[model samples]
Target: MTDKQTSPAVSVTLESGPAGTGSIDDFELFYARRALDRFRARLGRQGLLDLLAADIEEGNAFLRECARTSDGEFNAGTTVLQARGMTSAEFLAWMDAAFAGEDERPLLAAHPEHYAMGTDHIGARVVENIGPHVCSFYMGGWGTAAMAWAEDADELLPESEYPRKMSSNLFLEDGTVVGRALIQFGDTAEGFTANLTVYFPTSCPKGVLDHHLRHYAVEFRNWIVAAAEARA
Candidate 1:
């Protein structure tokens, strides 16, 4: 990825409206809400919730195996971000809220039209337009003890009594395993370090994989900043 950052272009056509009418920004806001509503409706029509419960169960098991074996059939990568003036606990508290759906604004605000539904600490269904593909996945995350993925036993931080670790697994609608993400945080004297690791099938194209890495960089950075701002 280039060091220079560029925002996505918006193509809005200005049209004259009646007196006291809303501005283009207002229309964009309305459209965004409508889009989310449509997405929610589509998921409802597909009976996704009923299937999601089962998918989460299977997906968790798949992720456990992946964590244990560190399978060669999957390609893995990590992105580390440092945040000053924030403790690891603080960052994790904000993250817990996000996962529980107490407040998703920070996550939704990270990107345009990012869709998420089903608010549970253990799982959520999300649809995101990442790179060349519009991807859908069932995401579930929890601490190492909850994960019960034995390999994590030796990975705990010595400095932390209850070290924060979020192991997230991604699965398709049909219960097909697609990817896994592990988010770990460690406290530093200055602040904390956030480590994000993603795993994808070996069959994934290099271009697609690279784009996802960049996507993680963009979204996570936005999320961390948003979290810090919220605390302020």
Candidate 2:
């Protein structure tokens, strides 16, 4: 990590859209350059599957609530999984083996409350990593999920040939409009960042959006910490 006294170790900035829109435009976060490099090194050696598994396990409770509230209808949005150890092909193979089998269960099976009994399979591309320095995964269960992986700073692009941002309209089973959620990934000179922007319709409650944001942040941080620790 960099010296906090001479240079700040970390910083967070929040910017919201025009009031009354019930939307978040930007939430910029920065991590120390050295620390980020260490995390990236660890991520590659440890692999994204392990980190993702840890993340889902840690956030099982919040995830359950989201699924239950949506009556089992939800979307995973865009999640970025960073790595370094293996090439894109190896990463995809590792992913297949990790979730392979006909009788697979949700990755959060440790928490019965969040476990959905059924075949939980994810389809991934092998030719290359989703963005630049990362591999992406799409998970299907309560609703669906899309994720990207970044192994280096170059992978995080505002726009890329591969799918960098994921968008979807969530709706209640009864046809009620829930809201729209957008997820994107990028990288700074020092670290990688994920942008999860959700826009709830005026009819939607703010509490719901708040919970989702909190949950996402918690899970992201948890994974990074877990990956860092494992690398150590």
Candidate 3:
């Protein structure tokens, strides 16, 4: 296949949102480059989501950290940009080259992390610059570990023209729900909380969505208590 004719199997889709200014475009490029690094350095696609998500999380965490240091306000994704003081293009190119070489996989591995048990790997992430402004909320499971997890309601007549709301747990090939992430905007001037809720099917089953959601009330409370201790 020609270089331009690369197969569709290995394509990457940027999670599109409102386009930003010139510098924001560069920021997107930099994050995209980080995604490329994970695609290359990881032991094939078996760990792609975790690797990529972790990279993204770490970058957000840095932004939170910088906010604390400067007594400033910033969100997770762009915080890395504000702290590093590099133009978007420079960061993007640096990340791209930092991951050159090796036998790139023929097909990206499916079922990354062999199916992580509800954020087991991500929970262990030591986020530098993590402040009160940014907290990756943990949820999804059989007990009191869920912060929040949502799902979609099926419609009776689905011919497929409507944009089906992308709700519910993010899944891998095996159909196991990984987690859901949201950039939460609250009453604070900081805007919102960068939250990620990991899901486990056993805890969040079909039919009693309300009852299942109630199980997480304690988890949020637990996070608050833990945060208090950390502050003390």
Candidate 4:
């Protein structure tokens, strides 16, 4: 007779942002922390989904890597990006286009046709200039469309998990070097949830990430303000 084994539940916690005091530095810190946590949560949730959807061979690997710590917990990091002016639909649409468009071919080293189009890991790209720190387009994920952790529509998932949508990646320059961004939509005061995760390579300075995040917040404000101006 075979003994039945049950896996432990996954626990997820999002870290808090900076304290909200009426100061410029405090405000900036608060948003930065917000972006980080939101992004992290979205990423973790997606990972959980992937783990649940893995094949036997792959599932075992994920279980080993995603094992609960001795503290009976799993720690996941996330971030947020706040862009005004655009509706959630508009923003999401823009993301889809930017990711699969021809602009990404140079960095990705292959056209959109190179992959089995419409999959999650296809020719995704991110192109934006938040502020003084301009981020070039970069390849997000490249390969099959099927997510390692996706389940059929009828499959049940844990209440703590959320289905996530991925965004294209951002590059530092026109080179093949890689950078990434992931997003999860949620309820927010600014029209839509802009849960975002932006990552840079280890070769880059940590300070660069801080600067880019700040600039990115400003960039979002600028984009919406500009859109409003265009309409006016």
- Best lDDT goes to which candidate? 1
* lDDT ranking, high to low: 1, 4, 2, 3
Cα lDDT of model 3 overall? Answer: 0.30
lDDT of 4 by residue, 1-232 (tens): 3224676697544356546446555566767756655554465533523443333234233222222221222111244655554565665555456445544322221211111112233233232332222232435442335222122222222323324455443322233434444445543456554554554454344554565565445544444454444346
Tens digits of per-residue lDDT for model 2, 107-203: 2221111222223232321111111112122332223432221222232445642334544444332233344556555444444455665543442
- Give residue 225's lDDT in candidate 1 (0 to 100): 80
- Residue range 1-232, candidate 3, lDDT tens digits: 3213444666554566758544555787677756755755653434544445665466344433433353321121101001122222332233234223232221111111111222243332211111211223322232223323322212211223222122233223222333342212122232222122222223222222232233233333333333333335
Candidate 1 on 1-232: residue-level lDDT in tens?
5435887696666666546678878777778867765665566524543545555455444444443454435676777787788887877787668867655556665665354444543358775543455555777635434345414533333446325666766766555557777667787789888777776766655655677777777777777787798889
Task: Indicate whether candidate 2 or candidate 4 has the larger lDDT.
Answer: 4
Off by over 4 Å in 1: 1-72, 117-122, 141-162
Model 2 segments more than 4 A misplaced: 1-157, 160-163, 171-177, 227-232
TM-score, candidate number 3: 0.22
Name the regions of candidate 3 deviating beyond 4 angstroms. 1-168, 172-183, 189-207
RMSD vs true structure, all candidates: 8.3, 16.4, 21.6, 17.8
lDDT of 2 at 111: 19
